[model samples]
Target: MNIFPKAQFLILLSEDLFSHPQETMNKVFQFLELAAYLSEEYLP
Candidate 1:
């Protein structure tokens, strides 16, 4: 059996970031196993 786990990777599109900043940040938080803690007002 393999002892090491696979690494995780997340890809963010520039268009999506510009179009949907909040959602994009949510995806990032989810990827890192963190709660959706960022709000729209905090995004650029």
Candidate 2:
């Protein structure tokens, strides 16, 4: 199976994500266009 070009993705390290959840999630929400539905305390 070939998965490229057609599929978009982002790779983040566990350490980086855990160390900077808010920043990381912001990027994710923006990428998925769900920033409007994101809440500050949602992940907490």
Q: Whose TM-score is greatest here?
A: 1
lDDT of candidate 1 at residue 22, scale 0 to 100: 87
User: Taking the tens digit of each residue's C-alpha lDDT, what string does model 1 give over 1-44?
Assistant: 26655556687897887788888888999999998886647445
Per residue, candidate 2 scores C-alpha lDDT tens digits across 1-44 of 27676337777677766787777777877878775445566343
lDDT of 1 at 9: 67
What are the per-model C-alpha RMSD values against the true structure?
4.0, 3.1
**Candidate 1 global lDDT:** 0.79
Clashes of 1: 0
Q: Please give the lDDT score at residue 31 for candidate 1.
A: 91
- All models: lDDT? 0.79, 0.67
Model 2 reaches what TM-score against the true structure?
0.60
